[model samples]
Target: MPRLPPAPSKHPSVLGVDIGGTGMKGGIVRLGHGPKSGTLRGDRFRLDTPQPALPATMARTLAQIVSELDHREKAPDADSRVGVCFPSIVQRGVCRSANNIDPSWIGVSLQDTFEDALQRPVTVVNDADAAGLAEARYGAGAGVPGLVMVITLGTGIGGAMINDGVLVPNFEVGSLELDGVMAESRASAKAREREGLDWPEYALRLQRFFSHLERIFSPDLFIVGGGISKRPHDYLPLLQLETPIVPAMLQNNAGIVGAALAAHADPADGLLR
Candidate 1:
């Protein structure tokens, strides 16, 4: 393979976009050298995810987001490079599976599509993996040693596994089977809403899920993310397990900041390899 470019320094700003089932959000991120280093330069810009969400349509929308966010006045040092996190299983820039996205996304090259649309250098990663990286380096999991698993309990369960600070990309723990069904089907935030579950009832599902994970990897820490993470006290205390679990500090912004980190850092620099 050809050599990759050297990682950018901590001072420059990079554009980060997070594509999800409901919305696409973007912002310019300024990176620093310590924990919670990624900060948005301006208000986050959001657009509804288009119906059908086809590659061509979404690419156009993505380009629009890039155009709106990559302004010289707001981010003078920002270059024509972008990092994107998508709701899919991305490996080496290719999307292997679609999550809450059109089935046409499977087998597509996420990096190339965005790069072609925006005419910029792009880094693409799985949304959950991006969140996990952010949490591991700059959020709740920061300074923690050994294995850390970041789990986002959103519309679906998304997982990322980090050892020390290096990411073991595409961990996909959400797919694990529990009670004869995919774990997310019963344990995810969407499932809670769909089933009209109270906080304690939801905790029961989460307890089962976490217990299952404990029996397997036995991670050093578990960082819970997603919209639900903002209200962690409601359900987190009810789960009984040997492992320590905490809410993600970055919460909804983790993917955006993590995408920026991926864009500015080289894959070999304690990121994905």
Candidate 2:
């Protein structure tokens, strides 16, 4: 297999936006020479994801957010690229599914829409894939050379599989079925909250779920992500598995940083669309 592009040096910066169910966040990531070296150019910005979350409605909000970020720069870097991470399966710039957002997003050519809205090139990808890429490149999974699986335990489960820093986008482990139900429905953080399962109870479910993953892929490392990762003490200690599982280091910023890193790489590179 061809080697992936070398990571950008510490000079260039790119804008990365992560669009989620409740809120959207963005920042400018300065490319760096080592893991954990990149820094946001300014404070990150967030805005509410439009109600109804329709394509056109969300596009307008995203445009406004990008403009706001642009205005913050004293002199905008014309070469800086923009990347947008969506909470859906994206392929060839087209969205394949919409679970948290409006169904209208399905089959939409979001790449064209965002490029038109921003008046520049924009790369779109799955939000989980973006976060996983960041973790593999610069966070918990950094330097691990074998299969690394990063799962986001949020309103729904999202997964990304990477090997030696190369991302396998839109893996969709969340869709796996267990007990005739979507795995996310039973094991996601939201599911735990909705079912009112305490830490130990939730940990048991996660233990079974992750053991299933280990059976299938035997990943070298597993990075657990999402807002709940902030308190790993609540759950991480209870699950026992052969694979080394750890909380994500970048937390919510992973998607933004990873999106920016993607923007810095060649467009034709074999990352997800």
Candidate 3:
């Protein structure tokens, strides 16, 4: 497996953005950039994504975040790049679906939205993919190779594949149909919430969910994350599985940081069409 190079000290810090259904989050990250240039200093915070979030509303939110961060840069000469991780399927730069957000978000050109508003290069990616990238690079899958699958169990099941070192985002394993029903229909924490089953019951189903993922991805390492991952002690012990699974090292902050990292990597600013 190819190795991801360390973040060099000479490089400037990359700005990371994480977009969610109700809120947007971000932070400046240094990656491996050294003690000063790439150091992450602030906490992740939220801004409402607006009810019935249309392209305009979302764009406004992004512009505000970048504008604020850009002011914080010590050297006005160093232009910062923006990375945005969206909670929807992002192909090229277009958000194909707004599963977790307002229906107005469908077909939104996320990259253009950010760039047009902020005038900074913007890279757009799936939120899960961003989280997965963080896990692969600095968290659970660090230094390990072959096949690494980062699975985020949140409102839905998010799967991202990293082969050698490249990221394959928005795998959408949750939407897969199983026995004439959707997999997430039974396995998601949301599903359990509706069913009124306890965590143990949910965990039993989660075991089956992970087993299915194990068979499909055949990942050498599994990094499980999401809000639920915060309580690994609660039900992870009840989960039965084959492949080795570990808690996502970065936890909830992975998506925000990964999105920022994406901005640093994409030359054209990772704009979607």
RMSD of each: 2.8, 1.8, 3.2
TM-score of each: 0.93, 0.95, 0.87
The local lDDT score (0 to 100) that residue 249 gets in candidate 3 is 78
Q: Put down candidate 2 lDDT per residue, 1-273, tens digits, no spaces.
A: 212356776557688999999999988787767544555778889999989999888898888878888877632464456989999988889999987889988999989988877788888989998898788777888778989999999998999898876787788988998668999999999999999999999999999889999999999999999898898999888988999999999998988987887777786776654
Query: Which scores better on lDDT, 2 or 3?
Result: 2
Q: Scored by CA lDDT, what does every candidate get?
A: 0.84, 0.84, 0.73
lDDT of 2: 0.84
lDDT per residue for candidate 3 within 145-195, as digits (tens), equals 788888888777777778767676677877876547777788766787889
| lDDT of candidate 1 over 1-273, digit per residue (tens) | 212133344557788899999899988877766432567787888999999999999999998888888664666343467889999888788989876889998999888898889887889878998898777767888778888999999888999888866677888887999899999899999999999999999999999999999899999999999999999999998999999999999888899988887887765554543
CA shift of 141, model 1, Å = 1.1
lDDT of 1: 0.84
